[model samples]
Target: MPEKVNGIVADAIRRVRTSSGVPLAFAGVVTGPTTLRLQHFVGQHVGALSGLSVDVGHGLGGKVVALNRLLAVDDYLRTPQITHRYNTLIEREGLRAVMAAPVIVDRSPVAVIYGAMHTPTPIGGRMLDALASEARAVEQEIVAARARMEHAAEGENEMRDRMTAAFARLRDLAGTVDDARIAEELEAITRVLIAGEEPAEEPTVELTGREQDVLSLAALGYPNARIAETLGITVHTVKGYMKDAMRKLGASSRLEAVVTARRSGLLP
Candidate 1:
């Protein structure tokens, strides 16, 4: 997990459990856009559950890992999932009821949050939700998945964590701002950051509206001509803005400008 995002997730999980009546306790992240590479379990008391992997077609989490669905086991050893990753941990914790919910983004499982109680009581369906709900504080894709609309941000759990934490502060800063404007900025920043390039460490400067427009499109991987068509501006004007941005960021390349912007937490 990115340092910034881990801070946010840790803070959020603590706040949610302390403030709410829900018994939800832990979460596990599966990172990647397509092939879900298992990260590790993140829980309230997670020191004991780290031996498992994001192994496909394996344990309970492995099953959720493979199927991208919610799973529950009343008795860890006897349950029909038929495999246990951390049996010693389960026994040590003395938990009887356990539930795992897939946190999806773009119709894929980016992470899973698990809740357990020390008794054999049934975990309510509503309660299973409280676990995953807190995860949304770190990544909107968690809550968004309940609505069942595929969100583009719902990719690797770690990247989503980094992206969300990096942007959440910016979003608050942009409070009450127009959605179109926000969308433009996100579109632009995404392009450069994900382009496998490093933006330079340039001094900060206020960008002109035209410059902002062009950078946003560029960040979203839009070509100069396509950006020109979308913004109803000339390709030459787009090139000019790119030049301005390069100078402002002291960047020699487009990727550098983007990296600097993202590291500064100004763009998504």
Candidate 2:
């Protein structure tokens, strides 16, 4: 997992543990294509869970990962919906009731967060909601982090392509030009390009808090009216913020602005 995702997961575990009144809250990030490794936790008696690997479709957490949804069991050891491969570990940890929510990104499970009770007590609806909310929050963070990385990779490729094109143009000009001094200058410019001098940086664009909020919602595929409803602002005000953000980003459309802002690390 990326550092950003790890940080978010850690914070989410703490928040879930406190807000949900769960004695144990732990997060397992996907360590392989079909495996989740318990990485972070809160609460005592969780030492046995450290570095535990939950395979997809095997344990309570694995069921969540396999199904990509929230799951709860009143008695984990007696749960029939999931396999009992991790029963030994669960028994060692003295956990009876368990709940798990999957952190999904792009419709795939990226991690699983679990909350458990030492006694066979059913988790409340509010606690379940809180755990699911934390999982969703982590999912959103992972999605944004992945988008930023992809955008950065695309930018690097674009820069390299532009540099290569410029170098070729300079070389072509140097070959066709008759003036030796101009040709030498062109060659010198090509040398500078080959040395990797970057182009002039674009002016930094700063968006206000509201502008950022609107754009972030837009990036998540929310319409202006929905964004307005979410932020408790008027649709007209949402449009205004979107317009301002688009102008600052030099984007010709809403999607363009969202892409640019995400690439610039202005949206999360």
Task: Judging by TM-score against the true structure, name the best candidate.
Answer: 2
Number of backbone-clashing residue pairs for each candidate, in the order shown? 8, 0
**Local accuracy of candidate 2 as per-residue lDDT tens digits, 69-133:** 89999999997888999888899999999999998887887788889899998789999999999
Q: Best by lDDT, which number?
A: 2
Q: Give the clashing pairs for model 1.
A: 26-43, 27-42, 32-156, 188-216, 188-219, 191-219, 198-256, 199-256
Q: How close to the true structure is residue 87 of candidate 1, measured as C-alpha lDDT?
A: 71
Off by over 4 Å in 1: 1-12, 15-24, 32-46, 50-52, 132-268
TM-score of 1: 0.44
- For all candidates in order, the CA lDDT equals 0.58, 0.81
lDDT of 1 by residue, 70-121 (tens): 7777777667764776577677756667776665555766666566666677
